[model samples]
Each structure stands twice: as C-alpha cells, then as structure tokens.
Target: MAAAVASLYRRVLPSPPAVDFASPEGKRLFAEALAAGTMEGFFPLVSCFQTQSEPAFCGLASLAVVLNALSIDPGRRWKGPWRWFDESMLDCCEPLDKVKAEGITFGKVACLARCSGANVQSFRANLATIDDLRRHLVRCVSSQDCHLIASYHRQAFKQTGTGHFSPIGGYHAGQDMALILDVARFKYPPHWVPLRLLWDAMNMTDDSTGLLRGFMLISRKTAAPSSLYTVSCRDENWKSMAKYCVEDLPNLLKGDNLDNVQTLLSRLIESLPAEAEALIKWVVEVRRKEEGDPSLSKEEKERLFLKENVLQQVRDTRLFAIVHDLQYANNPCCNCSSSSEEDSLTRIAAAVCCQGAAMLSGNLASRHGFCCKETCLKCIQANGDGLKTVISASVVSEGNEHGVDMLLPMSSPGASSCNSNLKNNVVKYPSSADVLTVLLLALHPSTWLGIKDEKLKAELQTLVSTDNLPDDLKREIMHLRRQLYYLKTCKEKEEYEDDDLPSPKWLG
Candidate 1:
C-alpha cells in the first residue's frame, strides 16, 4: 500500500497545473532546494517563511522535510555550516523561539533561513529589545511576523560564498540578539514547574541531534491552564499541535512497551474535545499505519490490527451517529419526502450486505480452491444476521437456477438435510438434532429432486421465513423463483403458450 501510494504521488506530482507552489520556475527551484538540503535556492520557501501568516503550514512542511532527511540518514548527525544557522535562526524570532524552547526543534529553521535573505543576526539581536514594546504593537508585530527570517539569513550566508560564521555586528544584529533572548525566556520561562511539565511531556529524544519531539500533541495556547487567554488563541495552532500528536503515534506504538502505548492512546482519546473529530481521524490513520494485516496468524500483528481497526471504527461510528442524530432532531419531518429515513435505512442495509459479500469474497480469494467449509460452519454457529442475510440471498439465487420454489423467507430454512449430512460426515459424532433431522429430510425424493444439500436448503428456508426482509429483496426472489418454476412447469407440462402470453426471452 505504501509503495502504491508512493507510485501514485510520483505520477500525480509531476504534471503542470496539478503541481502548484507558484511560477514554474519557483516550483522547480523549490524542488531543487529541497533535494539540495537547503531552501535558500527556492523563492517560494523564502516567500512563505517571510510572510509567516501561516506558521503552521511552514512549520509542518519544515518538520516533514527534516524528518524525511533524517529518515534518509538515520545514523548521521545534522552538522556543518547549517548548525549555527539552526541554533540562531529560530532564536531570532520570538514566537518561533517559543515553539522551539517548548521542545519543538529548529528542524527546518536553518534550511528555510538559508533560502530567504532575512537578516538573521539582526533578527536575533532584535529579540531582546522587542520585549519592551507595547503589548498592542507587540501583538500586531507578532501577528505580522514572517517565518522568512530564516530564509533571509540563509540567503545571506549563500551569497557570501562561505560556510564560516561571520558575525557582521550592526543594529539589525543587536535587535536580532535581543529578540532571541526574549524568545528563549518566553519559551523556557524562569519558573521551574512549567519547565518540569514540559520536560515530562517530551516523548522522544533523538540521540544524534539531541532534539526532543513531543508525544503529547497539546496546544500551548489552548493548554495554557488558563481560560482567560482562550479568546486570544488561534484554533489553527491547536489543530497543528493535534497533528503532531497524531504523527507521533506510530512511533509511540512501536515503542518498547505496548501496554504503556495503549494506555497513552486511551488517555489521548479521552482528552480529545468533541470538535476535534479530525484529530480522532488522524489517530485512526496512525493506528492503521502502525498495525499489520489481521489475516496474519501471528498473535502480535492480529491483536494490533484488531485493536486499531475496531477502536477507529468505534470512534468514527460514534461521531457519525451523533452528527446524524443531531441533524435528524434539528429537522424532524422535513417536507423532503425523497430523502427519508427509510431510504437511509435501506442504504445502510445494502452496505451491510455488500460488506458481508466482500468479506466472503476475500476469504475465498485467500483460500483459493480450498472450500471455506469451516468458515461457513462458524458463520452458521455465530448466526450473524447480516451474514445470514447475504448467505440466504446467495442461496435463493442459486436455487432459482435449479428451479426450487421454497416459500420460506431468507432468514431460516428448516435445517437442510444435505448440509446436516455433510456436517455429520465431516464430524465423527453428531447430535440427533444435527444428524437425524437433516438425514430424514434428505431421504425424501421431493427434497432431493431440486436441493443439492442441506446447507442450500436451509439457506432457502431462511430466505422464505425472514419476516423483516426488504420488500425489494422479496420481490426480487419471488420474481426469479416464479420465472424458474414457470420454466420447469412449462418444460414438464409441454403446454402450448397462447398468443396473449408473451414468449419467454430464453425460449428464443
């Protein structure tokens, strides 16, 4: 699946208009810079970071790039001229610095800065003095602040044609340094309690980079332990934090202790607000990624898939049910007759039937040429209404082919004599209910004339006896059986059709 997705990405990403970052040149430059370990070569990256209006996107993209790079070179430590840039780039921006000090690292700070010609030294210096600014102005400036500072700095370094750290002392440098300090202080603070909490929240520590990636994807703005500032926070930032939390799940699942991971997952799910349905979806996606195929007999893999898929479906279905209920309550008996609850119920029923059929098909595919006798027996024993519905429908269709007019609804056909015999034959010892009943029924010439086995007969009887069977399903089975019975009776009786009676299409 991963390979298929990768192939799809490759196919879709290379076309014109389909791939949009900006101008064709900009897109090319962006791709090149991404490949070259520096965003300094890309105008779009520089522009994006510089604009800084959407820090989440910039931050996420940066993290993705960094992670991709690290994945490629898992054993190597990030080093060279980029090291100083990494350390100082985010330090220059107050908000960026805060994010970093809160355990988020300068993953793409160096790359983005190198791409944009932001005055890195000056920006860093300004961090210190920026604190004294009026709260209103500071807020305004902070809101307008561009992530481009890093890109700008990177551009300067590239233009200089030197990897050496050349500190050109100036007003900008001074300002940048001040801002860096302020950001650092804002992120860490003087208080020990917050620091301890932050430390405790760090989920993973990269030994090579000495960087901490958070396990708990809680938003600093929303999770500040104060409701007073709630109105001031951006919802998007909270969502970004949630994404990080979800992205970390696969790694967390792969951790040493699975029980601990499951506990954490439960707590995370519990803590999620009702509005964060997307976050829940992301968690499901992460779980899917972490889990292996359930078909595997291996205990660990099967357990993981079962836990993940079931939990995901439960969460999704609950959300869906809630939304549906609210919508129904809000618009009780809307005049739109075409969009009725009955229609929805029918659709759900069809979906259930389709799912059952697909599952059976999958089983058949896996066991190619091997009869699913055991699985069928289990289904019979489990008596899943949905599975029973599908099996009865299938058998009705099969019986129609051989001209059997069993009047029973598709839920229960009195025990099939042939199926009973097969079951008894397969198993050494069978109860009287299981053996004698089916055998006695099978011995009858009428039952044997059309019916092949007790299983098929039982399925037909189930179809005939199902009281709540959908009208459409009933009509379909009745129509098919009528056609088959007519054909059989016509062939036996040799009655000449009157001109008024339409000739059967099959007769032609």
Candidate 2:
C-alpha cells in the first residue's frame, strides 16, 4: 500500500529536480551541457536570495534575478550599480507592494521589466503554443542567445506553495523538465520541473486580471548577463537606511506608552508584514476617532487600545505573534548572567572590533569570550524572540556591503571586555554582521556549522541530561534539538559559502 501511494504520487506530481546545481563538479557539468547546446546547468553564477526578509515578494525577487542576469538595471535612472538592491527594486516599485497586498498581475510584471529598459515579450495560452514555447525557450537558451522566466503554480511541481515566479537556466527535453532557478532559495533549491505541468499551471487564470500565466523574454539583442556588479551590499545609502531601521525596531519593541508606541509603529508599518500593518492601521483609526471626538481622554484611549487592541488582536499577525511568544519565553531570564547586559548593537561591535567579523555572542547579545566550552556543556540553549530581530535588522542593510553583510568598526564599549585595549565608541544601527550573527546564533550555532553539528548534538544531549530547567525552557530545548537534527541532516546541501557565517581573517 505504501509503495502504491508512492508510485501514484510520482505519476500525478512532477518530482523536483535532482541535479547537484551547487557543486564545482556540478558547475562543470552544467557549463559543458550548456556549451554543447543543452540547457542543463545553473547560470554561470547568480547571487542567491537566501535569508531574504520579505515573505511575499517572491515574484519581484525572481524578477530581480532575471534583470540581474541580463545586466539590466531595474532602476534605470538610479545612480550607481551599488545604489540598487534586489529589495531596492521591490521598495522603489510601489506596484510590487500592492501586488503583494492585492495580487500579482502580468501587467505589473511587464511594467517592472519595461522600466528596466528591456523589451519584454509575453507568451501564454493561445498567444503561443507548447511547441512555440519549446522553440523559443530551448533554441535561444541552448544556442546562447538569451534566457527566460516562467510563471507557474508551485504545487504543479509538488511544492508546498501556490503561485511562483522563477527563471529557467536549462531545459532537459529527454525528461521534459525545465530547470527552475527558484529565487526563494532558502525554501527550495534549483530543480527540474516538467513542461506539461508548468503549462497546466500557466493555463490557470489569474484572479487579479483573469488572464493565464505565461513566460517573459527579454530579446536576445538587448539582454546579456553582466559580470562587473559584485553586489550592492556595500552602498552608503542603503547602509545608512539599515542603521536607522536597526535602532528604531528595538526601541519600538521597548515602547513604554501608547502615544510613543503609535508614533514608532507608524514609522515601521511599511517595513512590516501586511497583517501587522493592517492591524496597526485599524487600531490607529480607533484611537484617532475616539481621541479626536472627545468621547475618551488620551488615558482612556491608551487603556482601551491596550486591552481591546494590542493584548488581543496584535497576536493575529504572524510575525508579531511569533515575536510576542518568544518575548514572553525570553523575558524571565534575559539579564540573569553577567554577559547579558549588552544589547544587539554592542554584540555587533564586539565581533567587529575584537574579531573583525560581524557576529554575535550567545543570548547576552555580546559575551566575555571565555569559558565557552565549559559553559556549552551546561548552559540551556539561548531561546528567545530576539533572534527574529536579527533578520529584521538584517533586512535593512543585508544589501549594504556584500549582499547582507554590514561593514562595521572594531570598537565598542564592550570590545575591551572581550579583547584588550579596544577604545569605546557610540554605536548606531547595528551592521549587517549583527543580523547575520544573530540569525546564525538563533539557529543555535551548533547545528548550522558543518563541523559542530554532531559535536553540538552531543553537547545538547549533555545539557538535556542535566537537571533543573523551567518547563518552558526545556520545551524550547526539545524543539531546538529536533530542528537541529533537520538543519544538520537535510540532504542536497548547497555550497552556500560553505554554510559557515562569514568571519574576519583574524578570527580564523
């Protein structure tokens, strides 16, 4: 019966691509296949959007990859190559936010492409047949003329989600699959997908415009992938913006009163997920009406809002709810240790100044850098919602230096505490490093590192073997161990910079 179900699933749903698209050996095979007139390899190189901040801009992110592949600047009028990020494309193009809020439309996509100065041609049902698509896609790409993108239902390929947008780097006609370059690399790897299934997905009408899904091509004459752009993460404008976001978020989390909280929330609405933003808007309106009309005093508004709005409805938002749960879980023990005094910014400063890498210490934000091995054996896993802040903080400047790395100084108030003789300085928005380190730490560094996966598993065993954690923390530890096993053991691991967080040469 199990075998029968497996067989039936295989027949009904197209399997994901099995190619090792990340290895150097894999790179060689792919290049040879492409040069020999087969679309069977990854694009020579593409900057991945792993650890991306926004959840809904998959289409825009995929489009960014397509535009980057063609060396086309989505923001044509924008100053330098460094001036525009993949997120820059999404943020600058307001239509994308609406597409995320309302729904993605072909017209919106076309406008985004045309704004990049590319001559785009859309191919779809009846507008072009399967044979027509095969000719255009296979011939142009195989012949080294151009590349194209496909819009399809992710479930057609047995993926977990609904609609998706991704670029196709190769075509394997014998098996009849188009090699899909998924921009949501963190969620799914680059894989081969069946054309018939892709077409079926495309044939489904769009709810936004009642039109079928399709492919978009930037003509051969105008499109060519550019190699000069290293990445836009080092840009001054974006980094400065990141600094502001980092400082503001923690403060917003620490907001003491209703008025201050509202003002802070208004500033962060654009950066938040749709549900959270909408909830904030509704609550703000309630306050506006009641406070302005004299039906309630400011104090009454605050009390009513906290009880009727924040305490209940705020949790309805996916991001905020997760944050709240983690907050409660972490609040009881945040500053219990000597190393727990520094905030996120100070942690970033210590790593950058003391080690020249942007990373974080454990739960304290920064640490004293001693007794690590001894502490590791007994310390409970640093579990909290603060780890989410790392991603939130990173979202701003992840593109600032090298696509989500922050260029920060090697000095802070706590730098001397870890190492000797580092001068103190005021810190602003934490660097890209702060976000990266925290994110890596959030996963409980032991499992994320290739060298430490098994060793940490053993360490976790020892910690769990000991006595006396609160029931909630022990629950967190159990959850962490399960997740750790998955992270450490997951198959088809890509050579994403070796899954090791970036560090300074001195740290090595």
Candidate topping lDDT? 2
Error of 1 at 382 (Å): 19
Report the poorest 10 consecutive residues by lDDT, candidate 1: 223-232
lDDT per residue as tens, model 2, 270-300: 3443222111011111111111222333443
Q: What is the C-alpha RMSD of each candidate to the true structure, in Å?
A: 30.4, 24.5
**Please, what is the TM-score per model?**
0.18, 0.38
Error of 1 at 447 (Å): 68
> Could you give candidate 1's per-residue lDDT for residues 1-508 as a string of tens digits?
3454432111122222112235464345445534543322123222222211222223423422222222221111122101112222221112343553343223223322212222111122112222322221222222222222111111121121111111100011111210110111111111111112222222234342344322110001111111000010112333443333334333333333323322433433344344442211111000010121212224323333333332222222222223223333445443124345234324333332232232223221122232211111111211222221112122112122111010111212212222332212221111111211221111212322233345544443332232333333223223222222232333232221122124333211
Q: Which candidate should be chosen as best, given TM-score against the real structure?
A: 2
Worst 10 residues of 2 by lDDT: 372-381
lDDT of 2 at 328: 29
Candidate 1 stretches greater than 4 Å from native: 1-62, 68-125, 128-152, 158-324, 328-508
List lDDT for all candidates, in order: 0.24, 0.39
